[model samples]
Target chain A: MTSHHETDIALDPELMAYVDGRLEPAKIAALEARLAHDSDAREAVAKWRHFDNLLNSYGRQADELPHSLKIAALERELASKLKKQHWRAIMLGTGLRRIAAGLVLFVAGWGSHAAYTTGGNMLASASHPYFVAPTLAGHAAFKLAAYQGAEFDGDNITSALDWMSQKMQHKIESPKLERLGYRVESARLIEVDDRPVAVFYYRNAENERVTVSVTPKWTEHGNYALRVVDLDDGVMAYWSSDQLHYTVVANDNRGAITTLAAAVQQ
Target chain B: MGLKSELHEHIGSLRRYALVLTRDPVAADDLVQETLVKAIAKAETFQRGSDLRPWLFRILHNTHISALRREKTRADAAPDLPEPIANDCQHTQLELKQVLSALDQLPEAQRNPIILIALREMSYAEAARSLDVPLGTFMSRLGRGREALRQIVQGVGRGKLSILKRKGDSA
Candidate 1:
C-alpha cells in the first residue's frame, strides 16, 4: 500500500465538504480513516484546518469591534440630516415671501451655496454655515426626526409650540413680532444643532415667509448672531438672539426682514 | 415591536459587519448610520415577513460600496486598527488580513453566501432565505468562495516560498 497517496493534489468535492463540516457521519469517518495512515491526506486536512482557523479567527475578532466609532458616525449623519431637514422646511414652504428674504440672507451670508429645485419648491442648502443650527435643542429635534416615531407637522404655530413646550418640559415661543407685518404661519418642533427647537414659519401680507426657530441655548454667553445670504431668486435673513434664531427669507423684500429683525429685538 | 425597534436590535451586528467591510471605525459607523437612515426613511416600503437583517445588510453593503467607489481607496489601505480594536485581531493578524482581502476580491454572489454562512453562522437553508437564492446557488457560491480563498492563500504562500528561495540562492 502506498504510504503517501499522490493520485491527485486537488481537493475533491467530497473532501471539500468534509473540510466545510458538511460531510455526513459515515463520510467523515472514511475521511478520518484515510487521514489516519496517509501523510498527504493528513497534510491536506492540516491545511484545511489552518484555513478554517484563520477565517474563524478573523470573525472571532468581530466581538471586539468598537461600538463608539459607529455611534459617532451616527451622530454625524443625524446632524447632516437635521441640517437638510431645516433647509427642506424652508425650501418646501408654500412659496412664502419671507422665504425670499431668508434666501437673501443666506446668499449674502454664505458666499457660495447650492440651491436645489425640487418639485416647485426651492430648497437652500442647510449645510451652509448660517442655515446650520447651533443650539442643542435644534440638533436634538433633528436627530429625533431621524429616528422613527417623530413626525414633523407644522400646521399651527401657537398650538404646536404650546404642545411641544409642554411635552418637552421647555418653554419655546416664537419671536415677539407685534410690530412686523409678518405673523407666524406655523411652527413645528424640530431638531437643529443637536437640540430640540421650534421652527416658526412667518408670513407677510404679500405671502413672503419668514421662520423664527427657537431652541434651548447651551452655548457660553448665549449670544445672538445673524447670517444673511443673497440668492438669485431672493434674500435669506438669519438672526439668532439669546432665546432663538429667526430666519426670514424673501425674494424682493430686504426691508421686511430688517424691519422684522429690529422689531423682534425691541 | 415595530420594524424600527427590530432593526435597532441589529445595530451592533451592522456595526460589526461594517467594521469588517470598511476596516475603519469612522467609515464603518458612517456605513451603519447611512444604512439606518435609509432603512428608516423607506421602512414603509419594506415588505412584511421579510428578513430585516439581510435588507439592512444590503443597504449597508451598498452604502459602503458607493462610498468606496467615490473615495477610490480601500478602508484596509488606511492605517490599520484604531485604538479600540487595535488588540482585537492582532494575534492572527496575517491570516485575518489574508481572509479579508480574499473576501474583498470575491464577487458579490460568492461573497454574500460566504458572509452569510461564515459570519452570520446561518445554515445553508437560512442563508438561502437571506440571499433570496436557491439552495444550490448558495452552496455553489459558498464552495466558490472557499476555493477562491484557498487559491489566494496558497498563491501568497508560494510567493513567500519563492522569496525565501531567492534569499537562500543569494546567501
Candidate 2:
C-alpha cells in the first residue's frame, strides 16, 4: 500500500484509512500526532470528510428523485421476464442468456448466404448409443433461441460464423447447409453449464426453425447414426466431431431431418 | 430473504450507483433494469450464501462498461453527458451536482474506483474484484481519482453555476 502519493496531494491515504476505520494501530498514534500540528493535513482530512459527507447527503436527497415509477415499471418488466424465463426453465428451455449489459439489444444486421449442400449420406448406419448431454437433449426438446442481446459481426454469413468462431475461441464456420435449402437465420451464444454454447438458428422453405447447437467437448457416443432424437415436442438429429458436439433440433420431420443431417455433416 | 427479494433489495443501491456512473436517470435505470434482467436470467450462477451486493455490482458495472464500448462503435454515438434527468430535478443539490460534475470529468477508469469506494462504499478489495482489476491498479486509480476530484473542487471554488451551463460546456 502506498504511504503517500508524491505526485498528487489529494486526500492522504493515511487519513482516508483513518476515517474509514482502517488505519493500523502503529500509524494511528503518529497520524494523530501529526494531525495535532499540521493544519494543512487537517484541512485535507476535513476535505475528505466533506467529500464523503456531501455524497452521503446527496444519496439521501437522490432518494427524492421520482424513481419509483420507473423502478416499478422495471420491476414489473423484470417480473414478467422472470416469469417467462422461469416457465422456460420448466419447459427445459435455455434458462439463462449470460451477458447482461445495460445497452440496447444490439441486433446485428447480416444478410443470409447459402452454405455447402452435400448429397452424400453419412448417417454411419452403426448407431453409437445416442450419447449426448442431457442438457443438449433438453435443448433439442424445446425451440432453440438465439440470445437476443447477441452482438454479431454480421456483414455476411461467413463473417458472422467467423465472429462466433472467434467469440467461442473454437473454430466455428458456417454449418454448410445453405445448399440444403436452409438459409442462415441468426447465430448467437447461450450459456450451458456456465459455458457459452454457440447456437445457429436457420429457417427452411417451410419456415421451420432449425437450430444447430455447437457445444464444446466431445461425448464418446457422439459418432452415432443420424437418428431422430426422441422428443415429444420436435425432431432432432445429432452428430459430433473432434471436440465439438453438434445437435440440430427442428420442428421438421424424419425425412427432412435425414437430408438435413446428411447435409450438415458436409 | 429469497433470491428474488434479495435481488430486489439492491435495486435502490443499483439505481443510485447507475446515476453516479451515467449521470442520467434514464440511463441509470436502464443499467439497473439490465442488471436485474441479467441477474434473474442467470440467477443460478449466484450461489445462495455468497455476498449479493458485490455480485450485483459486478453485473451493473460490467453492463455499464460494455454498453459504453458498444456505443463507441456506433456512427451516432451519444455525447459524454446526456443532459441528465436530474436537470428536471428541482431538488438538484448544487454541491452534489458539483461533485457529480467533478466525477464526470474523470475518465471512466478513475471515475469507477471513486464511485465504487467513495459512493457505493465498497471495500477496496471487493471493488477491485468486482471491477476485475488487480488491487494495485484499483488503488492507483483510487489515488488518482481522489486527487482529480480534489482539483476539480478547488478549481471551481464552490460557486453557484447553472448545471445547464455545465451540460452545455461539457457537451
Candidate 3:
C-alpha cells in the first residue's frame, strides 16, 4: 500500500525514467499526459535530458584519442629530453616491483631515450607526433628500444606472447616477421609510466635491429590510422586495432620494420 | 573480440568518469591507470560475455574508495573529499565547465549515477550495479541528484545545492 507522499516522491524518478527512455511505452504516454498538466515535472525531464546531452557531448569531444591528436612536430629533441627525464624518474622509483622477473637487473629502462626521428618532408603525407614518441604509446615503444639486451623474460616467441597475454588485457600475438628475414631475438617486460608492456627485440642476419612493443590504450575506437615518424637514425610506425596499440621502431629502416608492421597488421 | 578487449573498449569512458569523480586530472589519470591494471590483472575473475562496462566501473569505483581510505590513513587531515579541485580546467571545453562544476557540488553517491548513465551511456540498472546499490536507492539518488544538478548548473541559481544523504548512502 503506497501512500500519497511515497507516490509524490516516486513521481520524479518516474519522470526521470521517462527522460532516459527506460519507462515502458505505456507508462510514457500516461506520464506525458500527467506532465502536460504538471509544469514542474516537464521541466525536470527537460533538465535531465539536457544535462545528459551536455555530458555526452563533452565526453565525445574532450577525451583525446591517440589517433586524433597526432599533430606534426618539427622538433623531436624536446620530446626526447622529456622522455628521458620521465622514464629516468620512473626507473629511479621502480624498486624491484615485478610480477614476474627472474632476472636481477631492474635497470631503469628510462635511460634509453627515443631516437630523434621527426623529419619535415617525411611527414608531408604521414602524421607526425605532437610530442614525438613521448605519449604513453610512443614512450612504450621507444623506452623498449633502449632496453635491448635486458634479460629475455621469455626464452622463445610462444612463451613471450603467452606471458604478455597473461599479464595484459590485450592478447598480444607474436608477429611472424621471420618470413621477411626478421626473427625474434628475445622478449622482455619493461615498465613505462608504472604500467607493464611487453617488448620484443627482433634482429635479422644483417645485424639490423627492429623493436616492437604493444600497449593497451583507452580508446573510443580501435581504428587509429597508421602514423609514422622518421628518426634521424630510424623510423617509428604505430597503429591500433581492437584494443591493442602497436609500435614498430627500427634502428635501421631496411624495410624490415615495414615488413613487420604489415605482418603485425595481418 | 575476447574478454579483455571488451573491457578495453570502456577505457575512455572510465577515464572520463574518473576525471568527473576525482576532478583532479592527475588523480583521475592515476585512477584510470590503476583501474586498467587491476582489470587486466584480474581478468579471470570476470565472467565471460557479461557486460564488462559495469564490472570495469565497479573496479574503478572500489579503487577510488580504497584510495580515499588510504589517503585518510596517510594524512593528518584529509581534504574534504567532495570539494572540487581549484579549477585550472584546461581538459574540457570552456562551455561545459558549467556542468562539470555543477557535478562537483554533488556527493559521490549522487554524482556516480549521473556520470554513469549520462556520460558513459550506461543503463540505470547497470549504473546501480556499478555503485553496488539497490535499484530503488539508485533511482532516489538519481532523481534528487539530477534535480540538484539542474538547479546549480548555469543560470539556474547561485544558491548552493545540498541534498541530504538518505541514512546509509553516505558517499
Candidate 4:
C-alpha cells in the first residue's frame, strides 16, 4: 500500500478510536479482525500509538505554577473583589449614592466628547503637555473615524510636511506613496506626548484609507525591532529609523502600508 | 465559594495551557492573569451549572488569538532578521526542545486542538466544546496538526531545523 493509503487509514476515526481504546467491545473485535488481515491498518495503529505516547510524555512536562505568580494573582483578585464590594456599599449609601451616579453620567458624557467632535473628527484639538499615547487600537478607532469624516484633499500634504519640519527641527522626507497605488488625501499635525506627529492620509483605488504618521526624533527603547498593534478598525505598524519614528495605520490591509513605510525608510 | 475562589482553583491548569501556548513564562503569566480578570468580570455570563474549565479555556483562547494576530502583523512589517535557535543544549533537552519547537510551529487553529486533545488529554467532545467548534472540524484540525508535527519532528534531526524558521514563516 502507498503512503497515501497508510495516511488515510491512520486518519480513519474508527481506527483512531480503536487505538485510543474508545471503541465498543464488538467494534473492537471487528477492528481487530481487520487488523489481523490488513498489514497497512496494523502499521497505522502502531504509528498512532507511538504518536500518542510521545504526546503523553510531553504532557507530563507541563510546567508547575510558580509561587510568586500564584500569590500575586490571588492577592490581586482579592483586592479587586474588595474594591468592587466597597464601591457597591458606597453606591447603596444615602446621599453619596445620587452624587456618585451623577458623576458617572458626567464622566460618560465627557468621554464621548473626547472621543469625537461635533463633525465626527477626533478631538486632536489641543496638545496635552503630558499625554500618554493611546494603544494602537485606540489610535485606529480615532483615526478611522477622522478619516471617514474628513474630506480628502492632497493639497495639504506640503503644508503638513512643512509644519512637521518646523516643529520637529528636522526635514521629513515624503515617500512616493502614489507608487503603491495610494493617492495622498489630507494631512494634519497632531501632538502625542507633546511631540509633533505629522499625519498623512491616503486613499487607494479601492477607496481603502490609510494613515501614515511620522514622529521625528522619536525612538523606542524596547528590544523589539518592529511593533505591530491590531485595533478594532485597523492595524498599526511602528518602526523607528535613525531620524524618525513611522507608524503605518490601515484597515486590515497592512501589507500595502508596510510597503509604503519601506519606501519612506529608503 | 466566591467566583474569585473558584477561579483560583483552575490557576495551575490555566498556567500550563498558557505556557504551552506561549513558550514564554512571562507571557504565560500575563495571559493567565488576563484570563482570570476577564473571567471574574464576565462571571454573570457563565451559566451557574456549566463546567468552569471550558469557559476559562475559551476566554484564554480568544485572548491568545488576539495577541498572535498583533504579533503576526508586527513580524510582517519589521525588517530585522530572525535570531537563530541556540544549540548549546544536551541531547535529551534538545530532543524535548525539538518536539516543543515543532508544536510551536503549528498554526494556532491546528495547534490549539492538538494541545487540547493530545497533550491535555481532553476528549474529542470536550475539546470541541471548549474551542466552540463542531466535532468533525475539531477532529480534522487535530489530525492535520498531528500529521504536520510528526513530519516536522521526524524530518529534522537534532539541531537542524531552526525554531526561528517556523515562527518567522508564521508571519
**Per-prediction share of native contacts kept:** 0.10, 0.15, 0.25, 0.10
In model 4, the Cα lDDT at residue A179 comes to 48
lDDT tens digits, residues A1-266, model 3? 33354345334666777877788887878888988987766776787787887777655643663421111120122223332333233223343123113111111121233233456333233354322233333333434455332335325667667666776766777766665456787776665554556667776654666777766665443444455566656677776555666777766442334444666555
Candidate 1 per-residue lDDT, tens place, A1-266, comes to 11123224332556656766778887888778877887765666566556666655454555676556555455455434433333344334354345555645644553443232222222435543333332222322333345222334445556666777775567765566533445665456655444555555556553555555555555542433454455455555555554554555554344444554544433
Which scores better on DockQ, 1 or 3? Answer: 3
DockQ of 2: 0.09
Residue-level lDDT of model 2, residues B1-171, one tens digit each, is: 433564566677777777667666666777887887787676655543467778778899989889988876422232233333335343245556666777667788888877776664568788887787998788778766766776676665433445556655777
**What lDDT does candidate 2 reach at residue B92?**
45
Selected candidate, larger DockQ, 2 vs 4: 2
Candidate 3 residue spans exceeding 4 A from truth? A1-11, A65-266, B24-26, B69-95, B154-171
For lDDT, candidate 1 versus 3, the one ahead is: 3
State the lDDT of candidate 4 residue by residue for A1-266, as single tens digits.
Answer: 22686567736788767766778788888889989999877865675566555555554444554565554665466435543443344345464445555544533443543221121222242321111133232345445343222223587666667666787788986655674457877765665555666667777654666677666654543211334444445555555555666666666433333444454444
lDDT scores of the candidates, listed in order: 0.55, 0.59, 0.59, 0.59
* iRMSD values, candidates in order: 10.6, 9.4, 11.6, 12.0
Provide the TM-score of the second chain in candidate 1: 0.71
- Using DockQ as the yardstick, the better of models 2 and 3 is 3
State TM-scores per candidate. 0.43, 0.46, 0.44, 0.45
Q: By DockQ thresholds, what CAPRI class is model 3?
A: incorrect
Which stretches in model 1 have alpha-carbon errors above 4 Å? A1-27, A30-49, A69-266, B1-9, B71-91, B129-132, B161-171
Top-DockQ structure, candidate number: 3
Q: Output the better candidate (1/4) by DockQ.
A: 1
DockQ for every model, please: 0.10, 0.09, 0.12, 0.06
Model 2's chain B yields a TM-score of 0.70
